[model samples]
Target chain A: SAVISQKPSRDICQRGTSLTIQCQVDSQVTMMFWYRQQPGQSLTLIATANQGSEATYESGFVIDKFPISRPNLTFSTLTVSNMSPEDSSIYLCSVAGQGVGTQYFGPGTRLLVL
Target chain B: AQRVTQPEKLLSVFKGAPVELKCNYSYSGSPELFWYVQYSRQRLQLLLRHISRESIKGFTADLNKGETSFHLKKPFAQEEDSAMYYCALRGTGGYSTLTFGKGTMLLVSP
Candidate 1:
């Protein structure tokens, strides 16, 4: 099992503003992911952040709207850009441990865009 | 495309009652299924996985490839067992991304 933490546990941002959520893992991991959970909706994968490479984003999510940066194995960041009311959701960061299928999630960042 | 479906959004059961949270998945190849739980103020944590075939915190889940389902079950539920549960699938493809189902909130009332 791995321990993960996210910064800005909860934030209220004005529309059109941007907020970057940080994810830190206690151990180095090769696979890190970003997810979004909207009100009453399932957790949706936003992107896969790999160290020193471009992130692989899922459908319906674009790089321009949610940019990701993973400078190293233990850290990654997801920036919600040009936020709107619809973008208000709980953003989660998860990391998969080596040779294991289980992924541990961070304490989600609850963003409320006003 | 891999997908997970959790039919129930909420489930309420009395303490010490049997509880089952249904989860079904759609995947072509071998699937790695997992059950994650989130307590009221805690982070989402892996409760159990089918591949491990082990029980955690008195909870267990079995993968039924024939039915394409992996449902979580617990006998004699406890009040502390109340939490938001999510069923997730890991695709075997190179990406190793996880697709999660809509979570189920289990309310074990004492």
Candidate 2:
């Protein structure tokens, strides 16, 4: 498993503001993903962070709302733009490990939109 | 689309009793399944994977393609095993993002 760390473990932000969450891995990984878990809901895929390219978002997600930056193999950032109370959730980052389907996740960023 | 289904929202069991967490999947391609666990105040972690075919922490799961199920089981439950368990499925690819089911909160009482 990879050791992953996320910055701003938690933060409360005002609605319409944006907050950027950072994820760093101890070693370079081939894949990195961002997920969100809303209150009483399962984890939802936000997007897949691709190095040197725009992230590929899921059907219900858009880059304009959640912009992702993968500057390198070991680091990525996800910004929740124009946040709302509905966006209050725990955002997590995960990296693919050496084995197939082994995804080690970082401690999630708890975002509370006020 | 690949999807995982964990029917039980919560499972309560007594220590030393048997435990089983049901998981089902809907996928057309070959499925890679995983069981993830999260302790209170801790990050999510992989408990085991179907491909490994190995028991972890006294827990074991067998994939049944015909049934499309991978149920986690343990002969004896422990109080410390109480936590949230998630079943995930990955599409056949190099870096396919995992599709997770609604987690089952296991509560093992002494």
DockQ of each: 0.76, 0.81
Candidate 1 per-residue C-alpha lDDT over A36-99 given as tens digits, one digit per residue, 9 for 90 to 100: 9999998899999989899999889999999999999999999999999999999999987654
Q: Indicate the docking level reached by candidate 1.
A: medium
Model 1, CA-based lDDT: 0.92
| Model 2 vs. true fold: TM | 0.96
**Candidate 1, position A39, lDDT:** 97
Model 1 segments more than 4 A misplaced: none
Give the C-alpha miss distance for residue A48 in model 2, angstroms: 1.1
Q: Residue B59 of model 2: what lDDT? A: 97
Model 2: docking quality category: high
Q: What is the lDDT of residue B71 in candidate 2?
A: 98
Q: Residue by residue across B11-106, what tens digits does model 2's lDDT show?
A: 999999999999999999888999999999989999999999999999999999999999999999999999999999986555667899999999
lDDT of model 1 at position B41: 91
